[model samples]
Target: MPDLAARLRIEFHWRGGPDVVFADITEWWRDPVVLRDLPPALTALVPGPVPTVVLGPASRGTLLGALIAAHLGVGLVEVRKNDRMALHSPFHIARDLPAGYHEGGARLSFRRALVRPDDRVLCVDDWVESGGQALAIQDMVAEIGAAWLGLACVVDDLGDRAEVRARLGVRALLTAEALQAD
Candidate 1:
């Protein structure tokens, strides 16, 4: 795995209860020289059959997915949080929310047309912990009859959760240990 924590400056800030570490990859996302490095790094983990499409959930996943798709010369599919597309399917997701919600969860949806039966999909995310979003996305991918390539993230914060690790088999550029290091 690439030592992203060493290359990038990660800062710690208080979210609510305690300190939350954020990897400041602002330049990495903006500059091509940096972003171009990600595809090779990620594809090394999911290298076998060429994936047909890259799927990412609403928000930051879109950016990471887009870069991967472009690198692989495939299509990018955006999974939205709300009903943004005409023919969309929704799935319930529960995770650690950043306060304001006593109950933590949200509904995410994806356009049905973005995926085709024969399309091999690789799910991408900015950060993954509970694997809730990936699980929900897996259901959506199944509905479309697409082959799931596996989950990839900029950071895998799931710690030692073997269940989630076995399920998503997440390939990450950074781990919680690396990201949380001061």
Candidate 2:
């Protein structure tokens, strides 16, 4: 996994959408080398007291969380994003998240039964930019009386928002600038 960061940069690309430049990690997912190296790499980002259970925020996080959870020999909790299907399904939603796709309406939910008061949680995502999701997840973890260890992602794009990462205990295998390398 020594060359993982380098390989990640090489496989990473930027996709131009109608209004934005989104990162395309499809190539990373396709590379067996990356798949084999990623989980351990992300797990290493967290200092210690490895999580007993991991949390992924729907979509990408769900996939990444499963991999990393397996690496740590732990379990995963899938966090749903504003999905009506979660209503009354033992899922608790995090409130008052920062503006995003749904603005202030952004919400994150998770199954309360899956999380316990003494469990340590490490949230996994492909990328972390605004950190609103991590904060929201923290709220839900706190509500369940679980310990929120922090966030672990493939990429960290906090820019000048260093304080946010500090506040949320964010860590990543690559920085946004690392993927921009030539």
Candidate 3:
């Protein structure tokens, strides 16, 4: 586990509140110390050579994913929470994210001609608490027949990386832990 992952896990598990952990984790990325520490931490967690696509909720996870993509020299993909008219022909797939509402009705859309068939996608997010949203992005990648590289987050409170990997069929990378020891 990378040091950032440990820190994120601690932060999400300890300092974050029920309604606020998602925002808290996202906000942490804005801090210079945390931002500086993220890329290396993410690089340490990924297990293989698949490229990345970031799954963000409009304003939430976009910057983090974009930064990581820039650092790794890869592309970024957005998973929108609401539908947009411009994405008329986007490839649609349903996902159930951790903190998002609904069991499985959440949908993800990309610009129609954005991704190629041969693209291998690593899904990035700001946090992975329930794995639902990540799973949804994974489903979208599968629908496009793109190789599902892996899932990376700025925080992971679930603790069990194995289960997350098993469910999403990709290793989960977290940058920090919200929990702290006294």
Candidate 4:
């Protein structure tokens, strides 16, 4: 399944261009193993009783979060892109662009009410390009007074795990190189 997904990914990159590479689960899920293996890898990154919060623009990360939550027998939360009418009292967080990437001053908002104050959260995304998005989610968790377990992604492209950890104050679980090597 991973192989098939990898093949699809390669094809996507080849035909769709580099920016269109949808390596994240929520974006391109050709198999179930991508979802299956995510939890354990995430667990290895953060040692705690943390429930996973799927960050949105809903992608493979959302599916991965649902699978992980089901596997762990925990609840799931979503960090949405737009403040819909359903999210009346939503919490907002500004995501800074990660180092080296263009398009600065981009910010994302999340609802704090979606999670409980006592909930320990592990932010899950399909991919980590800059680490800024992940860091923004972490900041939202912090603002809500919820303990953050860490950040987990199907693919981490930045390669600077230490910088992600230091800036986000949590460990990054996966890297693009690791996934490609697998």
Candidate 5:
């Protein structure tokens, strides 16, 4: 098998054009090579301590987080999107996003039990663009009294948000620019 970057480029596609460009990553999840390699690749992106648990946003992030958590022999906490559903606990934490990449504003919440004060957390996701969700996760981590390690993603398109990037210690397998290169 070739390198992951080469495989990603081969399978990834950008739909539409001059006005709206949509980045399609569904194909990446279908490929066995990508599924098996993504966990380790994402793990390497961390620039801090080994996380005791992984916090993944709803949907795609949940899948990616599960894989990474399993690979690292850790636990996973799924942060729901715009959903109040959470594990029955008084310690549940939620953060509201004023703006997001897709949703104008959303709520992200998770059970406080999954993450503890002693646990170190790493947020895993398919992509990180605006950093809105990541910041929310960071807040949840704090509310749970857990230590925030960093964030790992498949694509990092945060533009010039140096402060967010530095604060999150964001790392990625490919830059959004890489996917756009044809």
Candidate 6:
């Protein structure tokens, strides 16, 4: 496969305090070939097939998680950010999320049906930063008596790599350094 990282464009986004550089893969993903190849490229990152389910939060994470789960031939479970679905015995975590998330705070929920005591899950997302949500997910997984195989992301913008790894093993396709503008 081609060097996908090098093909991405970078855009500067202002998030109140400072300008944040974002790796814009949306355009590159528009290409049918590239979109088709995403699953294979991401599958290469996983160590092995240890997870019975792939868990992703709403929005971007949910989209990518579905792809990864399909590639791995596992069940895809969504952690909802809203009460859109009628939940049955859901596990919830309310906390101060990062800037891009809900302003004051966000409530994250995982349905009891998707998460089981014996499940071995893989967490997938578009990006991971601050790791607040991921940590909360980890806590919920533990409470459910489930195992976390690892976390995979399209990008790693968060600087504290060690801290994130300490909490949950992570594999990122691209780092913020690689996404910086020329």
All candidates' lDDT scores? 0.71, 0.84, 0.60, 0.59, 0.87, 0.70
lDDT (10s digit) by residue, model 1, range 90-116: 432222223332245666666667788
Per-residue lDDT value at 12 in model 3:
46
Say which candidate scores most in lDDT: 5
TM-score for all predictions? 0.78, 0.90, 0.70, 0.68, 0.93, 0.79
Provide the lowest-lDDT 10-residue window in model 1.
Answer: 93-102
Q: Which ten residues in a row have the lowest lDDT in candidate 5?
A: 82-91
Q: Poorest 10 consecutive residues of model 4 by lDDT?
A: 7-16
Candidate 2 residue lDDT tens string, 1-182 = 44988888888888897898878889988998888888998888888797999999889999889999999999998988877766666555555566654345566787678899999999999999888888888888888888888899989998889889998899888889777764
Lowest lDDT 10-mer window, candidate 2? 94-103
Residue pairs whose backbone atoms clash in candidate 4: 25-60, 26-59, 26-60, 26-61, 27-60
- Listed per candidate, the RMSD to the true structure in angstroms reads 4.7, 2.3, 4.6, 4.7, 2.0, 3.7
Displacement of the residue 15 alpha carbon in candidate 4, Å = 4.7
Please give, for residues 1-182, the per-residue lDDT of candidate 3 as tens digits: 43655555444433457765323454465456667787666656777774745445445567777777788787776667656543454345444344335444555555534556688776766666666667766776777778876766655645566676576644445433434331
**Which whole-number lDDT from 0 to 100 does residue 52 have in model 6?**
91
lDDT of 6 by residue, 25-77 (tens): 55644566545665667667778656899888887788888888898788998
* Tens-place lDDT digits, model 4, residues 39-121: 67665666656564444334455676776677677777755544453334435444444444444444356555677678777
Model 6 deviation from native, Cα RMSD in Å: 3.7
Question: Which residue pairs in model 5 clash with each other?
Answer: none
Candidate 1's C-alpha lDDT?
Answer: 0.71
Q: What's the C-alpha lDDT at position 108 in model 4?
A: 56
- Candidate 2 is scored at a TM of 0.90
Better of 2 and 5 by lDDT: 5
lDDT of 5 by residue, 1-182 (tens): 77998888888888888999898888998999999999999998787689999989989999999999999999988989867464344667888887645748887888767788999999999989989999989987887688888899999999889899999889999988877775
Could you give me the TM-score of model 1 versus the true structure?
0.78
Superposed by TM-score, candidate 5 places the C-alpha of residue 31 at a distance from the truth, in angstroms, of 0.4
